[model samples]
Target chain A: MDTIIIDERIDVGAVFKKNIIKPRWFVWKGRKYAITEVTYTWEDTQGAARVMHFALSDGNTLFEVSLNLTSLEWRLEKSSVV
Target chain B: MTRTILLIDMNAFFASVEQAMNPALRGKPIIVCGRGRTVVTTASYEARVFGVKTGMNLYQAKQACPQVIAVEGDMSRYIDASHNIQRIAREFTDQVEMFSIDECFLDVSKTCRNEVDPQNIARAIKHTIREKLGVTCSIGIGPNKVVAKIASKMQKPDGLIEIREKDIPVLFALMAVQKLQGVGVGRHISEKLMSMGITTAGQLGNTPLEKLMHHFGIMGYRLKRIGEGKDDSPVDSSGGNELIKSVGHSHTFPRDTRDISIIRSYMMMLTEKVGLRLREYGLMGKTVYCTIRFGDFTSWGAQQGLKEHIRQNREIFFVAEQILARAFPLSKAVRLVGLSISDLKPRDTQQFLLKEMEKDTTLAEAVDDINKKYGVFTIKASSVILSEKFGIRPSCGMVSKQALKIKV
Candidate 1:
């Protein structure tokens, strides 16, 4: 359920819409992760959407779930986080 | 109708700036100078009450007021605050002349009418500087430039004095002769005036101009006119044709000493500072001058014109040191040593002999570029390090071979 809770907060649709998914690597409340999938809610609610993903650079770690924009406030983005 | 001119001088600019930033320094005796072994650039009015003053050696100032808090002078902050005050002055009139970093002359003739009070304008300037810049200034209003300058100094910080043309004799009666401009030129003339029982401006003004001239030549005629308030000098804001006339620096030691090594070391440091600035500004000078102030407050200056314009640190040091070598007593302790380079020319087109020296010229230009990009002290001569002194180290000191390209 906690993993599901984490999955729900990171909305893929909003991340893609705001261009925050690419080039971003960060930890949330001490959980290290990376964005892998972004999806849209609908055309009418243009900004509000959902996301599906895993944690890795160059497709190394496996994660799968659906997330909504209404939950998590934001995510971190950096030029080169290594 | 007599036009009123106001001269406003800020009290202890740098120290006051610090005090204004920090609430605790208010009413405290403070001297703003360089941290170790430097001249007191500005002394608070509290410190001045005890005979401490700007240009007095730090040790001498400490002798005058032992408890004075000495702060290193910050010219940048003072310049910022000065620009603010200058902006405020422009709100009143465009005819404002900056006399010094902390002093200004405002020609309010157009703004002030016959019945309109000049005191109101003085109070406005004072209040504006205090409220806006957190500093105070003394204002003096008089009929002419000399009288206005003297009147402004008559009062202390935040005080104002006004002298009208009709009241010149009355004002002259109460003031000493030294208070008049140009009266302290010679000792014998003062004694002669004293012998005649004409010891004040009023008495001197009463003395016929012809008799005064007979005693002191043309200067006597000038003195009589000054005594009677006949100064016609204008407040020239442009400082016309004085294009950076002389660039010089003087530093006072913590203690006075006659050691040639120490004196030469300080002069060398000063010479390098001036030389670097000359090169940075693309200027070279033919005339180099040196000044020495003794412990007794007596001073002497000597200058010589070089055969060619030079900007090298060694060249400036050599000329200044040579002058001092011939002029210095070698016995009397020196409190201050100053160096100035004048009669400047653009370094790019300077004529020179010797092929290697000309090559060195190109090298100097390249080094100047490096220093400008990476910051000063990025590149310096080995002689500068060999003759290292206890002053500013000349830069941020972060060395990198990679050139920092600054966009013009």
Candidate 2:
């Protein structure tokens, strides 16, 4: 269960005051359901900064968010590809 | 029995709290604003269809929409989403009031005692802020608080409307004599009330409030009681509990600058952050004011008063560097800079007979105890670390601008 998408002018409270919260997912739509409010920023325009973790929820109804330390690429769903 | 008063507001609030947290910023456009180099402190409506707005700047909001999406303001995440919508507007009323930080008001006339329904308690406070702050608000309902803040901006983002008292003269006859509120009007009194045909707010409530006080004085008796929804004003629950006559800080220079030494090093770091929040609110003002804004967004502000009541950040950066050297005019290029202070008092002043002002209040209590234990500039004032090495500092608590994760 992973779906992260966030983008639009970043900063969900400076990415929840600089990330670290994951008790294995459950974040859905309306902006990954406001990732428990605040923290998010992904800059680079002479502003110099790039970071991630948008996992608000992907545990169903397809609502996920990403930014968990940049470098991303994924596609999996063969019964959670065991 | 006129008293329901809702208000609510929020839409486009920091781009709907950054599109409720970022479903690819839902239908794009955003903006947010204010981190320095000023203007545009709220845009989205898909960046107001590319003309972009809220105080403009950010280089004319990236020349009116270069794929908008700016974002900067946070104000502690909109004051923690206005303390979780003032904790669900204190479950419908302790007569709420917050009023700014994306507005709020409530009253709920004795908790809807005359049997609920201020438009279903503004749709149960917009479904308890969309099932607990997923965002979207609007709300309005009215009986006061200036017709519930003009029926909470008349609607957008989860609207609710209400007006009553026989729909205040058909909603002040389809609004607009500058949306008839306080008629701050201008654009030359909306081109002299649209060349005297006076467009709307029912033709300025049928004109003659003595010819709008013979051409606007006392803002034409407050635009004939804001075109008759008549305000009585109340709702000031003294959150700031008065006496802070002033204490300011301003910035607006993400660019445009004809440097008067970078606007006196951002007016000595916003008069050293309004003299460290007026010596951490022990207080002491005696006036100071000093605004600016230029690059055509026009703004000026001045104030003076002093002769004492200081709180020293080198006397509020030499009275905001002599009111930005006689209210600016080094022709163009400034973007903004402010630093208020105003009359206030309370710092229990008494120990003065002077010994070099008790060695400058023991060097401002040893630079406010090493900037409150190694935090702020950690013991500043060598001309505030040479005005933060020639100014514009305030990056507000950095941890490389956090973003480790939570993009959901």
Alpha-carbon interface RMSD for all candidates, in angstroms: 25.2, 12.2
Kindly list the per-residue Cα lDDT of model 1 for residues B237-262, writing each as its tens digit.
55322355656777666567777777
Question: What is candidate 1's TM-score for chain A?
Answer: 0.26
lDDT of 2 at B384: 47
Deviation in angstroms for B119 in model 2? Answer: 1.9
Task: Show where candidate 2 strays beyond 4 Å.
Answer: A1-82, B1-7, B14-32, B35-43, B47-96, B109-111, B120-137, B140-156, B160-236, B242-271, B276-310, B314-346, B358-408
Best by TM-score: 1
Q: DockQ, per-model, please?
A: 0.01, 0.05
Q: On residues B1-408, what C-alpha lDDT tens digit does candidate 2 reach at each position?
A: 557777888888878876775555658887876554356768888888888888786688778787776755545455556667767877777666675667777777886776767788778778887776677888887788777778777778678887876888987787776665332455677678778878777677667888988887778887667667776666554444545566776766666677687778777766766787688778888888887877887887787887768888887788778777886557777777777887887786678687998798778877776665445556555554544654453443221111111121
lDDT of 2 at B198: 83
User: Where is model 1 more than 4 Å wrong at Cα?
Assistant: A1-82, B38-43, B47-72, B113-116, B181-192, B239-244, B253-265, B276-284, B294-301, B307-314, B327-329, B332-335, B343-360, B369-376, B386-389, B393-408
Q: Assess each prediction's global lDDT (C-alpha) against the native.
A: 0.66, 0.64
